[model samples]
Target: MIDEKGILFVLSGPSGVGKGTVRKSLFDRATDLKYSISMTTRSIREGEKEGTDYFYKTKQEFEDLIKKNRLLEYAEYVGNYYGTPRDYVEETLDHGKDVFLEIEVQGALQVKENFPQGVFIFLFPPSLEELKNRIINRGTESEELVKNRLIAAKTEIEMMDAYDYVVVNDEIETAVQKIQSIVQSEHCKRERVAKQYKKALEADFS
Candidate 1:
């Protein structure tokens, strides 16, 4: 049978919504999938390695890429430019490997416009109260920043309908299973099924 087409899986959610956790779980289940590392002009955090955690670049280098149209989608977030490089994603897809990208709402929209075939998944908190608690529990930001993030989270949650699938992360394992199921089901689409059947019929006739 012919191999299924590669898929671009776009995952997005608000801060403290367990996106990273769910993504790691999904990767563990789907071994062949690859996560696309994004590029940013923001300073690298401690212990972050270039080309692994993120493609760290200077502001001037980032601007040069924008001028050359090398990025798939880019946006300035809190004074730093963050974007996905077009080449790496395209290259991965060409080799029939699924590419997973974790991006913000704006970047996700831009990717949808540019790559209409991409599958968009939005992770949602179980409840607004629970979401607020998750942010507070992290203790990574000041109270003021937490408040701002909560506001942003609400806005992002409201935009869930824009995605193709919505998975509520009440439990980590359940959420990961939902994402895995979505990816597996997509591979069995009618188009892919028909292609396989056609090849089988031709082989038999010949």
Candidate 2:
């Protein structure tokens, strides 16, 4: 079999758009793609495992990584730092296993600049009003924080043009279905599959 490099699929959107939820649901079912774990300075939450949820780091450690350019993209949100490690992603793709990155808008943009070939998908809320409700419903953020998130979400939504596809998060199952379909379609693109076929043809001639 021809070994082709794997695709990087980035899932990002406004703060309250359910990117994480959708990603979890997609992975819960059978799939071949690997999840690219992010590193964070924030304290691990309940039920979250180290390396699985995030590679937890101290502020100083995270800053050192920044200095060394070990991270593909990093962002400071609220009071914590979050980023994707460059080595793991590159190595995984080289091994022909697809990678899925569920990240925030800023991080996603940074990844796009570094890896333009990635499939960027923007997960959108059904409505701005619904987005607001979702953020508020979390009960973890202050009223002021909720307002700030909504503002940020509005700006991020405006940047949807930067993405290759938009999947509305009105329903988790529907969004997952659409995203799955997109990944399947991307793999079938002639430009991608043709390379392997061309190699096979050359081998036949040899």
Candidate 3:
């Protein structure tokens, strides 16, 4: 068999663009890709489990990891820290398993810088009005924070040029299907498959 390193797929977009929802739905049906678990200093909720929901850590521990350059990207939110662990992602990729990350725009950009070959996808809302409504409907954000989020969303949407694919989150099922199709197409890309094919040919000749 031809040995191949796995691909890193980063899915990110505006805050209220349904990145998490689409990701969860995609994983519900697809089994080949492994989810990249993030480390966080946030307290685990009742329904959450360690190593599954998030790799919980203390603030100092998280700071130590940051100092050691163990995280690909990190951010502070609501007085808690959250970040993607570099070691886990690298090990998973090296083992020939595709790794998926669903994150925010800033974190996604950091991953792109670290892994330039990663498949970066930008999720988009059908409209700014719809996005605003989604965030407001959550009822978790204060009115001021909601306004700030909309402003941030506009800026994030402008960064769509950086991504390899753009999928509109009009319908959950449709968005999931499009993302799956993108992954399939990426796998078939000549640049990704050629190396393995060449190795297979070399082995056959030998």
Candidate 4:
């Protein structure tokens, strides 16, 4: 049997849009899928690790990587630089492991431009009201921050059409299933299957 090639899966959404939750579920259910850990200049949180959660780096170190063009997509957010490292993602794909990147809208767009074949999915809440409730329910941010996020969510929703697929995460299980189905469908694309068949035919002829 021929080995399968990996794909880059980009997942993007606004804060409190359940992107993290859905991504966790997809990771739990999909063993072959690998999550990309980003590199950030922000201080590590209480329980986060350096390499696992994020490659914690100083401002100078991150700037050096940027200068060397080592990052796939990077941005300075809230006084900290966060970015995805290119080597790890490319290595994972070379090993036939599908890499999933849970990134912001800007990063997702950058990835799409860098890797035209990448699959991009935008997860959205069922409605604005539900999004507000979800943000409040999380209880991690202050009321003012929640309000600001709501405004940002509205703006982000406008970019949904840029993604290849929009998944409304109204229900967790259903949303997870939909994402899984999308991945499965992508693996069946004619281009990928045709490449496999052509390789097999060449081997047989040889």
Candidate 5:
């Protein structure tokens, strides 16, 4: 909410949810939106680009960033460290471009503390059973890991009230449209336009 800066739109949810897919569709439709790339200590997988996919860093480097308060939020997941660097988001926002972040619930909460005015959107799966199926279908995790994620999803969903908005991902298109509308609405807030109003009034007085 800095003067003339852009909104820090945070998208967060448990694993296997379609947060990434929905985020992609949103930016595809709204090309003006900027994506915040995350930094990770995890090894790069096949077909993943350095900046586009993630800013892969060593554990020591990531820890140094944390020590310097350069990272907005960070957490270890499945033995890999991941975090959102504050500089990129702030720089893009200062340029008057909205930046989007896809993070987990834990990391999102941290952002909430640092950027209270940020737009927090929670993406929900159609159902827990379907969520489990989606994770299993990914074929990345074992049966036990899938079960653990499902258990965690339930707890995460219960905290949905903590977010500014929640969209049920029954259909990706519908979800994207709803989020798009939310952005449009946020841009219309009176406080967001106060600077323009003040400038106009000053000109009249002059």
Candidate 6:
């Protein structure tokens, strides 16, 4: 395997940008990429499993992990704390399995600070008005909450430059294909190929 490291693909976008739908479609058509499950202090919602949805932790426990620096990135959203565990990500990459992290912009930025080698992807809506409509159409949050989210979306969009690739989720299938292409192309990068060449040369001379 030439000690090739797996890609850490972190996905981020504003709320109502259809990131979930696009991520699902992308994974369905791809292989070998594992999802990086996060831990949270939020109450388990209906039908949410402890391990599957999130590693549920109490506020104190979550704080302890933060103090110990065991979390790769942590963010408090709407009173609930969510964080990616450092150990899990490290182990997955050590196994040469790509890990996909679909998170909010705050958490994504934090991840970028800790792991600059990660491939950061940002999902966007076609337009601001379109993003508003998408959120309203969902019928999940109250009117006030929706308004707040729209404001937050603007802020998130401004930070798009932090990401390496921007995917517009106007068409789910098309967005998925674009991200798939990015992943495939990243695998062929010179940094990775050079390592394999070095390993082969060493083996031949040994």
RMSD of each: 2.8, 2.8, 2.2, 2.5, 3.1, 2.6
Clashing pairs in 6: none
Model 1 alpha-carbon drift over 4 Å, by segment: 42-51, 56-61, 77-80, 140-147
Please, what is the whole-model Cα lDDT of each candidate in the order they appear? Answer: 0.86, 0.92, 0.91, 0.87, 0.87, 0.89
Q: For residues 121-203, what per-residue lDDT tens digits would candidate 5 score against the true structure?
A: 99999888889889998888988898888989988888777799998888999999988888778887888998887887888
Q: Highest lDDT: give the candidate number.
A: 2
What TM-score would candidate 6 get against the native? Answer: 0.86
**Per-residue lDDT over 112-175 for candidate 4, one digit per residue giving the tens place of the 0 to 100 score:** 7777688889998899889999999998789899889998888888887779998899998998
Residue 205 in candidate 1 has what lDDT?
100
Residue lDDT tens for model 2, 25-90 = 999999989999889999999999997889999999999988998887998989999899887888
| Better candidate number, 1 or 4, judged by lDDT | 4
Error of 5 at 34 (Å): 0.7
Q: List the residue pairs that clash in candidate 4.
A: none
Candidate 1 per-residue C-alpha lDDT over 6-119 given as tens digits, one digit per residue, 9 for 90 to 100: 899998888889888888887877467789988999999999999898899899999998899888799998999989987888888888888998777778888887787889
Kindly report which residue stretches of model 3 are placed more than 4 angstroms away from their true locations once superposed: 43-49, 140-146
C-alpha TM-scores of all predictions? 0.83, 0.85, 0.88, 0.86, 0.83, 0.86
Kindly indicate the candidate among 4 and 5 with the higher lDDT.
4
User: Cα lDDT of model 1 overall?
Assistant: 0.86
lDDT of 3 by residue, 116-205 (tens): 889999999999899999999988789899999999999999989999999999999999998888878887899878988988899899
Worst 10-residue stretch by lDDT in candidate 2? 1-10
Residue 151 of candidate 1: its Cα lDDT? 90
Steric overlap count per candidate: 0, 0, 0, 0, 0, 0
